[model samples]
Target: MNELQNFDFEGNEVRTVLINGEPYFVGKDVATAIGYQNTRKAIKDHVKTKYMREERIVTPSGTQTMTVISEPGIYQLAGQSKLPTADPFQDWIYEEVLPSIRKHGAYLTDEKIEEALLNPDTIISLATQLKNEREGRLIAEQQVKEFQPKVSYYDKVLSNDALMTISLIAKDYGMSGAGMNKLLHELGVQYRQGGTWLLYAKYQRTGWTHSETKMVPRKDGTEKAVLNTKWTQKGRLGLYELLKTNGYLPLIEMKDESAV
Candidate 1:
């Protein structure tokens, strides 16, 4: 995961992460800052799955999974909001956060550019660099346009939702869902009942997990709705801390340490 960067928007903190060189805003942070009462519902209803991603973010509490949205997703949420601060929030993002992220460094002011233009040697060097960069950007843009349709289709398919199942979460720890469930049970995080894993009583109503009803095909070719529990980003983060405290680390973290 990329390092988390925080930006202030009128006293609200918006966290962002970079994935594959593209910036993504933390969904809950953006939604809350935009004055949404129900942040999760707002994001789910307004943001497309293709524009959202689940990533583990390291915070003061611990490493936790969170949903991050792309720039377009940010616009979509801001555009739909009816709050008074919506317009100002959009302006802040466009005029500050986005430009900062894209530049990834200090930007030259117009006066600085003009000064550089006066120096013949600097002008030649800058012109050559700009020409090469423009050419590279053009080629990349052309390739993206050519493959955009297919890429869009696949992105939609692969990113169906931001929620993650126990099985999916277990993969990070190189364990099966059953194995992870058993471990959590032993660690007093959850308990299995009625062939389903449920959080312990103390952890209930804490937004750590969400129960979703999924349709399961029966042997008779019929389908039945089954209540399935999935880990929320918050839950994933909690789990990371719990597991880490017990001396278990995710595969990625292990790999990072090994490399160091």
Candidate 2:
């Protein structure tokens, strides 16, 4: 994939490139946007190897190996960023930038099968199957495009430097923890069963969250292993959007960082 997409974050241009059916962002650009004075140093110190990969990207000068960060890597960097605008910038990344790239990137198209079907002896059945496959892909693409939220939905809702717990999110909506779980269920994000937050089946299959094993003391004075469900940056923004749509307004206004 040779496609590139650019978006504005914190009044700076952030460039993303499509590589191998996935979006990889330029590390230097990301670092600069997040207010790091030393781009290479920040990436080397904070970004993990798995999150940061070196790849040859085409540029006006020429193709060169640049450090690129995967989606998860971007979130990790956001968590580590210390700049004042880090939180809001992260919200923009998960809400506006990624969706825009996925919506406009040309790499999502399937490889052409025309060469294989150019033979004179190409069977009618094979041709029909290929045609059906193309039609199915088109339909799926259309469905995805229709399912995405409008551009305005990308606006930042909450501003926090750390991950939000279930209780925190609930408190924002004037609901209890249990009530919040129900709200999450209604939004298809997760459900509560046996006092545990279980990710919905669809999200489980998609690997949208990070789970950790925590030892919790039971009423019987015995420690039991519990799986903690931590909501990612993207997941938090998504829930924020869902709540806003369902009439949940923020009790406190977010900090105004326009001057920054």
Candidate 3:
């Protein structure tokens, strides 16, 4: 840091006030002040308020004078920064959002829980997800230890080779074709719907397709029922609730090239 010093500018309209080793604008009054102390305070006040706090300042003027920046007014700036921090959003997320998702996550899919945890995404959201994931795993592990797994009607249908045809189930389990369809509908299965599989980005559901069921017809004329569910995001994080809690699907490696 440059210190206040006595200097003569050889009587010019423009003059330099050298502090420690830097030049600070001292206003014409302080630049032509009677002594070093006055010149020093003018420069010190400027350094404290402006360049030092706003950013690092460098001067290439003559003399080895360089002042270590000591700006107290910078405290006001320290209170505000460009980089996102967790301070502001901490209260709502930790107290409200995260806990709410954790409570409701079982009914929700992993994707939806993640969405709630990510809504109004702030640093707190990131922290919540990072930490909540660990707690979530622990919570899930405990839930699994207590879990009672059961197969859905779809699973029962899929597992049957002799009754691969929906028509066969309608003949046997179903009272009528429509009654069988009603049973399937009650259990959330689709018979003949077809459309594009991938939803568009920025979809209304925060990048997730509404949980849906579709029945595809195989070449053998019997419908091969498929549960069309996947997370919109690559990690399939949204579906973790379903995967971990309900035990609907087999565990597979969750891909994360971004972490690499």
After superposition on all CA atoms, what RMSD does each candidate show versus the true structure?
Answer: 16.3, 13.4, 26.1
Report the lDDT of model 1 for residue 7: 95
Give candidate 3 regions above 4 Å deviation: 1-134, 141-159, 163-176, 182-260
Q: CA lDDT, every prediction?
A: 0.76, 0.65, 0.36
lDDT of 2 at 182: 80
Clashing pairs in 1: 64-237
Residue lDDT tens for model 1, 1-260: 46688998878899988665467899999999999999999999878898898998888778999999977677777766658987789779877886786462322346647867687785666566556545644664454343333333333324454678889889978999899999999999998778789898889977889997899999999998888888877777678768878988777666655764
Once model 2 is optimally superposed onto the true structure by TM-score, how far is the C-alpha of residue 167 displaced, in angstroms?
Answer: 31
TM-score of candidate 1 to 2 decimals: 0.42
Using lDDT as the measure, the top candidate is 1
Candidate 3 lDDT score at position 37: 35
Q: Tens-digit lDDT track for model 3 on 25-106? A: 2233222222223534544543344443222223456444333322121211222222233122223323443344445433
Better of 1 and 3 by TM-score: 1
The residue-level lDDT of candidate 1 at 102 comes to 49
For candidate 2, give the lDDT of residue 242. 66
